[model samples]
Target: MGKWTNLIKQTTDSDPISGAVNTPIQLSSTFSQADFDTYGHFDYSRSGNPTRESGERTLASLEGGKYGYLFSTGMAAISSVLFIFSSGDHLVVSKQVYGGTFRILHDVLPRFGITYDLVDFSNIEEIKKAIKPNTKALYIETPANPTLNITDISAVVALAKEQGLLTIADNTFMTPLTQRPLELGVDIVVHSATKFLAGHSDILAGVAVTNDDELAKRIYFIQNAVGATLGVTDTWLLLRGLKTLGVRYKRSSESAQTIAEHLQADKRVVQVLYPGLSSHKGYDIHQRQASSGGAVLSFDVGSLENARKVVEHLEIPIFSVSLGAVESIISYPPKMSHAELNSEELLEVGITPGLLRLSVGLEDVEDLIDDLDQALSYID
Candidate 1:
């Protein structure tokens, strides 16, 4: 059998007699085996579970990887990958990334003597300039958070290989459906299943898919050692979320595109930042790398005061922190997602108080626009 098929088959979960796939959650903390091996190698839930294995295996196929590992959250996957590098090793990352990741790079990892350089990945030269002799990895997010900037994964991967550095892509925003970074040459692909993969704000999980068996084993070691494996209930929740991902993307992406166009036309808005925009800086590159424009978009409303006004006044769309849910929601990254950042730090990544990010849902386009139109008046 092909490697992909084999991985799928081995990792798949099924009812012993029923033959039902995507088997029910296995909550047992320990499994019994014969010959005093009561807890077979897979004895504990933290080391592995059927539900989690199925989810990881499914993601492995979707991302075109030989193996997949599920984590307690997306950050866990990223943190673990970064762990491979020792103290004093340098890492280069994009300037505009998910708030939580930014915090980890800027605030936490440095404590362990792991220094990182935040650069404008949109410019290959800038990234090249930032790469130090001690650089161990190039961590980036395409269609970056809040700003939606795109990075050329193939080019970056080639660059990393030439430098003998590892490459990791945060594939959460694109999901495997839109962009398979691994296929484009990324060594590792990370996802915050909490968003697109889960398609609901119900579960918090993360996963890393890789083609390298040794690397996978190393990551597995850390995952098991760290004991951040996904819980049974959350794994089931993620499984349920995956069932409708295609349908969810279909409706939500359309709504997001229409809203982005409408926002571009509105005089009150300074600019619209969606990959769907023809004039967007990375729109072309994004199309080449991603399957769709994605369901999330961000825009500027002139000033922080105006931004606050629109978010606080939205009537139909719910204002919340997360981006990919069944209900339309808006987020103020500087306040909601990046509240941890200091004033200067937030501004460094272009996350100004006036910037408003939107996670479009399956709602009707007219209502979303109407809600925004009415909310615009509240800005003044």
Candidate 2:
């Protein structure tokens, strides 16, 4: 219960009826009531289910939060949080967030009268300048998407408190093991559970955890109203994935550090963006907040031609989109994750064609390095 491995392993409450070690999935859509006057803990599956409840409780416990809500997808969970704010309410968001998140804030939310200003959260002063009277929240992704940039959580939380603004952080990269935003005073934490949380890349789920009871109440209402609750089967699958996160993330991160160092030494790579490297600009601040550098890293291969050659020729990692899988994944952000952004928007966020993001898996470091070396050799 105290450590991460224990936290994940013991998430399921044992079945009292069957004496089973794991929590059994309650797949029924409705539960029979004991009497006419009293309703059971659950009524309809959309509002709540036993399997989803167990997973939610575990997620909340892991993040040191009081409540957790499950969603069918990461965006659904994030959208639920956004729905809490009304029209004319504004938000300050990190500039380099996931492309889907960017699209929602930039393209979708504006239609509903909600507005956001994307700012470089790495610079605390810049964040201060971006805040306005209408700003209701600050949404950020630390170890930001594609770029791997780090933002100081505690500092931002302090500023948000002073301004009476709620703080939400996407903790998908670090997971609860490496970084817990709630512990650092963030109001809410969101995760794309398909990543490290599920490990196997099999489930598409999202979770939001919060320490504030009031916020949790509002979030749960939105989740039920939107009807995006995670199904019983996926919840069970996600639970299975959570059990191995500690070991998988540790091994992957170790390999990623080795690969990042190897790539940094090569003349073909202009830059390796991993907080584990001391050369990374956010290394010191990252070390202060997170327990490890995490398993995801990105590098600049100098040009679009070199980047494409390296990804297409790589034999080990899948040169595909999405990350934090048991198998290594290499992605071209400009075309895949951030594809919605046009050339101008891409440049503003620092996503370039030369940049390739790698999510190191539980593969041997030497093998990964060799695969990368061979792929890069073809670039010249």
| C-alpha lDDT of all candidate models, in order | 0.84, 0.92
Model 1 TM-score is 0.94
Q: Estimate each model's TM-score.
A: 0.94, 0.98
Off by over 4 Å in 2: none
RMSD values for the candidates in order, in angstroms, are 2.9, 1.0
Residue by residue across 222-318, what tens digits does model 2's lDDT show?
9989899999999999888888888899999999989999999999898899999999999999999998999999999988998989988999999
Per-residue lDDT of model 1, residues 161-222, tens digit only:
98898899998877777788988889899988888778778888999999998889989998
The numbered model that scores best in lDDT is 2
- Where's the lowest-lDDT run of ten residues in candidate 1? 2-11
